[model samples]
Target: MATDVTVPTDLWEGDLEAVITNWLASDGQAVKQGALLAEIMVEKSQFEVTAPADGTLTITQAADAIVRKGDTIGRIG
Candidate 1:
């Protein structure tokens, strides 16, 4: 089974879009639930996105891409 890794809607206030600053783990890397996966920046503030489940990560959105809340950035399977 695969699980979608999403940018949390509650990461910050407002409907601001964020930039994917970096990915902690490369595509196809094995990850554990709650492990840091990527970093997102909104203006000057930054936040980290974590793995949603224990599986192999497949990045759908790469670094420097703009994303919104609840957007699926990757999948784990």
Candidate 2:
């Protein structure tokens, strides 16, 4: 089974959506729960997003992708 990783709704509020600034892990890589997976930039501030579960990361969205709260970014299995 696969687990969808969506952006946290409570992440932040702004006029524009968040942009992925950095990817700490690569697609198809094994990531542990609570590990830093990527960094998001919103309102000129950077925030790190962690893996929700221990599994192989499958990035459905690419780096530098524009995203919003509740958007599905990837899946883990």
Candidate 3:
């Protein structure tokens, strides 16, 4: 199974909207736990979202795209 990159609760403070700024890693790229996977912008600020575990990352959202807090930005498996 794959994992979803849900927006961090602290990042949005209950807000479910966010904008993707950039992806540090390409789609389907292998990543280690705690590695920076992408940079997200929420509430007018930017933040880095790290991988929770080691796996192949598949991006479900493109850069500059808007995503909800619980939206599937990508997956690791």
Predictions in order: lDDT: 0.97, 0.87, 0.82
- Rank by lDDT, highest first: 1, 2, 3
Candidate 1 lDDT over 1-77, as tens digits, reads: 99999999998999999999999999999999999999999998999999989999999999999999999999999
Where is model 2 more than 4 Å wrong at Cα?
none
Q: How does candidate 1 fare on TM-score?
A: 0.98
Candidate number achieving the greatest lDDT relative to the actual structure: 1
Q: After TM-score superposition, what is the CA distance of residue 69 in candidate 2 from its true location, in Å? A: 0.1
Note the clash tally of each candidate.
Answer: 0, 0, 1
Quality of model 3 by C-alpha lDDT = 0.82
Tens-digit lDDT string for candidate 3 (1-77): 67776656666576557888999999878899899988888777888888977899988888999877667788899
Model 2, TM vs. native: 0.90
Which regions in candidate 3 have their CA more than 4 angstroms from the true location? 14-16
Overall local distance difference test of candidate 1: 0.97
Error of 1 at 7 (Å): 0.6
| Model 3: lDDT of residue 25 | 94
